[model samples]
Target: MRRVIMLRALVWSVLLFVVSFGCAQERDPIVRIQANALSKAFFVGDLKDPTDDPEFYLRATVVDVASGAGSDGLFTNSDAQPTVRVRFEITEDMLLARLTYERID
Candidate 1:
Protein backbone atom coordinates (compact mmCIF):
# COMPACT_ATOMS: atom_id res chain seq x y z
CA MET A 1 0.00 0.00 0.00
CA ARG A 2 2.83 2.42 0.91
CA ARG A 3 4.67 1.71 -2.33
CA VAL A 4 1.53 2.20 -4.41
CA ILE A 5 0.75 5.55 -2.78
CA MET A 6 4.35 6.77 -3.12
CA LEU A 7 4.43 5.85 -6.82
CA ARG A 8 1.12 7.58 -7.44
CA ALA A 9 2.30 10.67 -5.62
CA LEU A 10 5.48 10.80 -7.71
CA VAL A 11 3.49 10.55 -10.92
CA TRP A 12 1.14 13.28 -9.78
CA SER A 13 4.10 15.52 -8.90
CA VAL A 14 5.63 15.04 -12.33
CA LEU A 15 2.32 15.76 -14.03
CA LEU A 16 1.85 18.90 -11.98
CA PHE A 17 5.38 20.08 -12.77
CA VAL A 18 4.90 19.59 -16.49
CA VAL A 19 1.53 21.33 -16.49
CA SER A 20 2.86 24.34 -14.57
CA PHE A 21 5.91 24.66 -16.80
CA GLY A 22 3.80 24.62 -19.95
CA CYS A 23 1.54 27.31 -18.56
CA ALA A 24 4.46 29.59 -17.70
CA GLN A 25 5.94 29.30 -21.18
CA GLU A 26 2.64 30.16 -22.84
CA ARG A 27 2.18 33.25 -20.68
CA ASP A 28 5.09 35.06 -22.35
CA PRO A 29 4.69 36.67 -25.78
CA ILE A 30 6.79 35.50 -28.74
CA VAL A 31 6.72 38.24 -31.34
CA ARG A 32 8.88 39.92 -33.96
CA ILE A 33 8.76 43.68 -34.58
CA GLN A 34 8.46 44.97 -38.11
CA ALA A 35 11.78 46.64 -38.98
CA ASN A 36 10.15 49.37 -41.04
CA ALA A 37 7.71 50.05 -38.24
CA LEU A 38 10.43 49.98 -35.62
CA SER A 39 12.74 52.35 -37.47
CA LYS A 40 9.94 54.72 -38.39
CA ALA A 41 8.59 54.97 -34.89
CA PHE A 42 11.92 54.94 -33.09
CA PHE A 43 13.70 57.35 -35.37
CA VAL A 44 11.15 59.43 -37.26
CA GLY A 45 8.11 59.21 -34.93
CA ASP A 46 6.14 58.22 -37.97
CA LEU A 47 3.43 55.63 -37.52
CA LYS A 48 1.87 54.53 -40.81
CA ASP A 49 -1.56 54.94 -39.32
CA PRO A 50 -1.98 58.22 -37.48
CA THR A 51 -4.32 56.77 -34.87
CA ASP A 52 -6.84 58.64 -32.74
CA ASP A 53 -6.16 60.61 -29.55
CA PRO A 54 -2.93 59.61 -27.78
CA GLU A 55 -2.05 58.66 -31.36
CA PHE A 56 -0.93 55.08 -30.96
CA TYR A 57 0.86 54.91 -34.30
CA LEU A 58 3.55 52.48 -33.28
CA ARG A 59 3.12 48.79 -32.56
CA ALA A 60 5.88 47.71 -30.17
CA THR A 61 6.74 46.44 -26.74
CA VAL A 62 7.86 48.94 -24.11
CA VAL A 63 11.55 48.35 -24.58
CA ASP A 64 14.98 49.93 -24.64
CA VAL A 65 16.30 51.79 -27.68
CA ALA A 66 19.95 52.63 -28.19
CA SER A 67 20.95 55.73 -30.07
CA GLY A 68 24.72 55.34 -29.84
CA ALA A 69 23.42 54.68 -26.26
CA GLY A 70 20.48 53.09 -24.42
CA SER A 71 17.00 54.36 -23.53
CA ASP A 72 13.86 53.26 -21.73
CA GLY A 73 10.28 54.29 -22.49
CA LEU A 74 9.15 57.53 -20.83
CA PHE A 75 5.76 59.19 -20.41
CA THR A 76 4.42 62.63 -21.27
CA ASN A 77 1.21 64.76 -21.06
CA SER A 78 -1.40 65.47 -18.34
CA ASP A 79 -2.79 62.00 -19.05
CA ALA A 80 0.72 60.61 -18.31
CA GLN A 81 1.17 58.62 -21.47
CA PRO A 82 4.41 56.85 -22.34
CA THR A 83 6.14 58.24 -25.47
CA VAL A 84 5.21 61.48 -27.21
CA ARG A 85 6.88 63.37 -30.01
CA VAL A 86 8.78 66.29 -28.55
CA ARG A 87 9.87 68.95 -31.01
CA PHE A 88 11.72 66.92 -33.64
CA GLU A 89 14.48 65.91 -31.23
CA ILE A 90 15.40 69.59 -31.10
CA THR A 91 16.09 69.77 -27.38
CA GLU A 92 19.10 67.94 -25.99
CA ASP A 93 16.99 66.54 -23.11
CA MET A 94 13.84 65.76 -25.11
CA LEU A 95 12.98 62.36 -26.55
CA LEU A 96 9.98 60.91 -28.39
CA ALA A 97 8.35 57.93 -26.78
CA ARG A 98 5.41 56.65 -28.78
CA LEU A 99 2.80 54.37 -27.24
CA THR A 100 3.47 50.78 -28.13
CA TYR A 101 0.74 48.42 -29.34
CA GLU A 102 1.99 44.93 -28.65
CA ARG A 103 1.21 42.18 -31.13
CA ILE A 104 0.97 38.73 -29.63
CA ASP A 105 1.82 35.74 -31.75
Candidate 2:
Protein backbone atom coordinates (compact mmCIF):
# COMPACT_ATOMS: atom_id res chain seq x y z
CA MET A 1 0.00 0.00 0.00
CA ARG A 2 2.79 2.49 0.87
CA ARG A 3 4.66 1.72 -2.32
CA VAL A 4 1.55 2.33 -4.45
CA ILE A 5 0.95 5.72 -2.77
CA MET A 6 4.56 6.78 -3.35
CA LEU A 7 4.37 5.85 -7.03
CA ARG A 8 1.15 7.80 -7.52
CA ALA A 9 2.63 10.87 -5.83
CA LEU A 10 5.71 10.69 -8.06
CA VAL A 11 3.60 10.55 -11.20
CA TRP A 12 1.50 13.49 -10.09
CA SER A 13 4.59 15.54 -9.32
CA VAL A 14 6.08 14.91 -12.75
CA LEU A 15 2.82 15.85 -14.52
CA LEU A 16 2.50 19.06 -12.52
CA PHE A 17 6.06 20.05 -13.31
CA VAL A 18 5.56 19.62 -17.06
CA VAL A 19 2.30 21.59 -17.08
CA SER A 20 3.78 24.52 -15.14
CA PHE A 21 6.85 24.67 -17.31
CA GLY A 22 4.77 24.88 -20.51
CA CYS A 23 2.56 27.65 -19.12
CA ALA A 24 5.61 29.74 -18.20
CA GLN A 25 6.96 29.71 -21.72
CA GLU A 26 6.88 32.87 -23.87
CA ARG A 27 5.52 33.81 -27.34
CA ASP A 28 6.84 33.59 -30.89
CA PRO A 29 9.05 36.04 -32.81
CA ILE A 30 7.20 39.37 -32.87
CA VAL A 31 8.75 41.01 -35.88
CA ARG A 32 8.10 39.75 -39.40
CA ILE A 33 10.47 39.96 -42.40
CA GLN A 34 8.20 42.35 -44.30
CA ALA A 35 8.29 44.77 -41.38
CA ASN A 36 12.08 44.63 -41.26
CA ALA A 37 12.28 45.91 -44.84
CA LEU A 38 11.36 49.39 -43.67
CA SER A 39 14.38 51.66 -43.18
CA LYS A 40 13.42 52.97 -39.76
CA ALA A 41 12.94 51.96 -36.16
CA PHE A 42 9.96 49.75 -35.33
CA PHE A 43 8.64 50.15 -31.81
CA VAL A 44 6.58 47.34 -30.23
CA GLY A 45 5.09 48.45 -26.92
CA ASP A 46 4.56 46.64 -23.63
CA LEU A 47 5.55 43.05 -24.43
CA LYS A 48 5.02 40.78 -21.44
CA ASP A 49 5.56 36.99 -21.25
CA PRO A 50 6.13 34.52 -24.12
CA THR A 51 2.43 33.81 -24.82
CA ASP A 52 1.27 37.10 -26.33
CA ASP A 53 1.06 38.61 -29.81
CA PRO A 54 0.49 42.34 -30.34
CA GLU A 55 -0.57 44.31 -33.39
CA PHE A 56 1.21 47.61 -34.01
CA TYR A 57 2.59 49.93 -36.66
CA LEU A 58 6.02 51.27 -37.64
CA ARG A 59 7.48 54.77 -37.73
CA ALA A 60 10.47 55.71 -39.85
CA THR A 61 13.28 57.47 -38.05
CA VAL A 62 16.46 57.81 -40.18
CA VAL A 63 16.40 57.24 -43.92
CA ASP A 64 19.33 56.16 -46.04
CA VAL A 65 21.63 59.17 -46.50
CA ALA A 66 23.43 58.50 -49.78
CA SER A 67 20.79 56.72 -51.85
CA GLY A 68 18.64 59.81 -52.64
CA ALA A 69 16.29 62.31 -51.04
CA GLY A 70 13.26 60.42 -49.67
CA SER A 71 14.77 57.25 -51.15
CA ASP A 72 15.07 54.33 -48.72
CA GLY A 73 17.53 52.48 -50.94
CA LEU A 74 20.46 53.56 -48.82
CA PHE A 75 20.90 50.11 -47.29
CA THR A 76 23.17 47.63 -48.99
CA ASN A 77 22.02 44.64 -51.00
CA SER A 78 24.40 42.32 -49.16
CA ASP A 79 23.56 41.08 -45.65
CA ALA A 80 26.65 42.75 -44.19
CA GLN A 81 26.81 46.16 -42.48
CA PRO A 82 24.11 48.85 -42.17
CA THR A 83 21.50 46.75 -40.44
CA VAL A 84 19.12 47.15 -37.54
CA ARG A 85 18.66 44.82 -34.58
CA VAL A 86 15.32 44.93 -32.77
CA ARG A 87 14.76 43.38 -29.35
CA PHE A 88 11.13 42.92 -28.34
CA GLU A 89 8.63 40.80 -26.37
CA ILE A 90 5.04 39.71 -26.95
CA THR A 91 2.07 40.83 -24.87
CA GLU A 92 -1.73 40.69 -24.85
CA ASP A 93 -2.58 44.20 -26.08
CA MET A 94 0.62 46.03 -27.04
CA LEU A 95 4.05 44.78 -27.99
CA LEU A 96 6.97 45.38 -25.65
CA ALA A 97 9.33 47.86 -27.27
CA ARG A 98 12.84 46.90 -26.26
CA LEU A 99 15.61 48.66 -28.23
CA THR A 100 16.69 49.22 -31.84
CA TYR A 101 20.21 50.00 -32.99
CA GLU A 102 21.58 50.75 -36.45
CA ARG A 103 24.92 49.32 -37.57
CA ILE A 104 26.34 51.41 -40.40
CA ASP A 105 29.72 52.59 -41.52
Candidate 3:
Protein backbone atom coordinates (compact mmCIF):
# COMPACT_ATOMS: atom_id res chain seq x y z
CA MET A 1 0.00 0.00 0.00
CA ARG A 2 2.79 2.42 0.89
CA ARG A 3 4.62 1.78 -2.40
CA VAL A 4 1.47 2.20 -4.45
CA ILE A 5 0.64 5.53 -2.81
CA MET A 6 4.20 6.76 -3.35
CA LEU A 7 4.07 5.82 -7.01
CA ARG A 8 0.84 7.66 -7.54
CA ALA A 9 2.19 10.78 -5.82
CA LEU A 10 5.33 10.73 -7.99
CA VAL A 11 3.32 10.43 -11.16
CA TRP A 12 1.08 13.34 -10.23
CA SER A 13 4.06 15.47 -9.28
CA VAL A 14 5.72 14.92 -12.64
CA LEU A 15 2.49 15.60 -14.50
CA LEU A 16 1.96 18.85 -12.61
CA PHE A 17 5.52 19.98 -13.32
CA VAL A 18 5.19 19.30 -17.02
CA VAL A 19 1.90 21.15 -17.33
CA SER A 20 3.22 24.24 -15.48
CA PHE A 21 6.40 24.36 -17.56
CA GLY A 22 4.45 24.18 -20.81
CA CYS A 23 2.11 26.93 -19.72
CA ALA A 24 5.02 29.21 -18.78
CA GLN A 25 6.76 28.69 -22.12
CA GLU A 26 3.58 29.56 -24.01
CA ARG A 27 2.83 32.70 -21.97
CA ASP A 28 5.22 35.10 -23.65
CA PRO A 29 6.88 35.59 -27.02
CA ILE A 30 10.39 37.02 -27.14
CA VAL A 31 11.27 39.84 -29.53
CA ARG A 32 14.67 41.27 -30.40
CA ILE A 33 15.52 44.65 -31.94
CA GLN A 34 18.84 45.83 -33.32
CA ALA A 35 19.40 49.59 -33.51
CA ASN A 36 21.93 51.62 -35.46
CA ALA A 37 22.59 55.20 -36.49
CA LEU A 38 20.00 55.15 -39.25
CA SER A 39 17.46 53.18 -37.29
CA LYS A 40 13.91 54.51 -37.16
CA ALA A 41 11.18 54.39 -34.61
CA PHE A 42 9.28 51.09 -34.29
CA PHE A 43 5.57 50.64 -33.81
CA VAL A 44 3.34 47.63 -33.22
CA GLY A 45 -0.38 48.01 -33.55
CA ASP A 46 -3.54 45.93 -33.74
CA LEU A 47 -2.51 43.50 -31.07
CA LYS A 48 -5.28 41.16 -29.96
CA ASP A 49 -5.50 39.08 -26.82
CA PRO A 50 -4.88 35.43 -27.38
CA THR A 51 -7.44 34.55 -24.69
CA ASP A 52 -9.88 36.91 -23.07
CA ASP A 53 -9.73 34.94 -19.84
CA PRO A 54 -6.13 36.02 -19.14
CA GLU A 55 -5.06 39.63 -18.55
CA PHE A 56 -2.98 41.21 -21.34
CA TYR A 57 0.39 42.88 -20.73
CA LEU A 58 3.43 44.12 -22.60
CA ARG A 59 7.01 44.57 -21.32
CA ALA A 60 10.17 46.06 -22.86
CA THR A 61 13.75 46.36 -21.76
CA VAL A 62 17.04 47.70 -23.18
CA VAL A 63 19.34 44.79 -22.50
CA ASP A 64 22.72 45.89 -23.76
CA VAL A 65 24.37 48.56 -25.92
CA ALA A 66 27.72 49.43 -27.42
CA SER A 67 30.16 51.59 -25.50
CA GLY A 68 32.82 54.15 -26.51
CA ALA A 69 35.89 55.78 -24.95
CA GLY A 70 35.19 58.45 -22.37
CA SER A 71 37.13 61.22 -20.57
CA ASP A 72 36.86 59.21 -17.31
CA GLY A 73 40.22 57.71 -18.40
CA LEU A 74 38.84 54.27 -19.25
CA PHE A 75 40.00 54.35 -22.88
CA THR A 76 41.59 57.67 -23.67
CA ASN A 77 43.12 56.73 -27.02
CA SER A 78 40.19 54.65 -28.20
CA ASP A 79 37.80 56.02 -30.80
CA ALA A 80 34.59 57.63 -29.51
CA GLN A 81 31.09 56.81 -30.58
CA PRO A 82 27.73 58.48 -30.24
CA THR A 83 25.72 57.65 -27.10
CA VAL A 84 22.13 56.67 -27.64
CA ARG A 85 18.99 56.78 -25.52
CA VAL A 86 15.98 54.62 -26.17
CA ARG A 87 12.46 55.65 -25.34
CA PHE A 88 9.36 53.55 -25.23
CA GLU A 89 5.68 54.42 -25.17
CA ILE A 90 2.94 51.83 -24.63
CA THR A 91 -0.76 52.45 -25.16
CA GLU A 92 -3.90 50.41 -25.39
CA ASP A 93 -3.68 50.07 -29.15
CA MET A 94 -0.03 50.72 -30.02
CA LEU A 95 3.54 50.36 -28.83
CA LEU A 96 6.23 52.82 -29.96
CA ALA A 97 9.99 52.81 -29.51
CA ARG A 98 12.36 55.59 -30.53
CA LEU A 99 16.11 56.09 -30.29
CA THR A 100 18.06 59.32 -29.99
CA TYR A 101 21.83 59.76 -30.23
CA GLU A 102 24.32 62.32 -28.94
CA ARG A 103 28.03 62.66 -29.68
CA ILE A 104 30.34 62.06 -26.72
CA ASP A 105 32.78 64.75 -27.92
* Top candidate by TM-score: 1
- Which candidate tops lDDT? 2
- Give per-residue CA lDDT, model 2, range 6-89, as digits (tens): 999999999999999989968787875584363322333323333343334434454435454553454334323333444555
Error of 2 at 10 (Å): 0.1
Candidate 3 residues 16-75, lDDT tens each?
999998888454666565555322222222234312222223334345435863436544
Per-prediction TM-score: 0.30, 0.26, 0.27
lDDT over C-alpha atoms for residue 23 of model 1: 83
Write one digit per residue (lDDT tens) for candidate 1, span 1-105. 999999999999999999998888445686676655433344445444343223333333445544665333342232354343322221355645543455355
Q: What is the C-alpha RMSD of each candidate to the true structure, in Å?
A: 17.3, 16.2, 15.7
lDDT of each: 0.50, 0.53, 0.50
Which candidate order results from sorting by lDDT in descending order?
A: 2, 1, 3
Lowest-lDDT window of 10 residues in candidate 3?
38-47
Candidate 1 least-lDDT 10 residues: 82-91
Ranked by TM-score, the better of candidates 2 and 3 is 3
How good is model 3 by TM-score?
0.27
Off by over 4 Å in 2: 27-105
Clash pairs for candidate 2? 26-50, 27-50, 44-97, 45-95, 45-96, 46-95, 46-96, 47-96
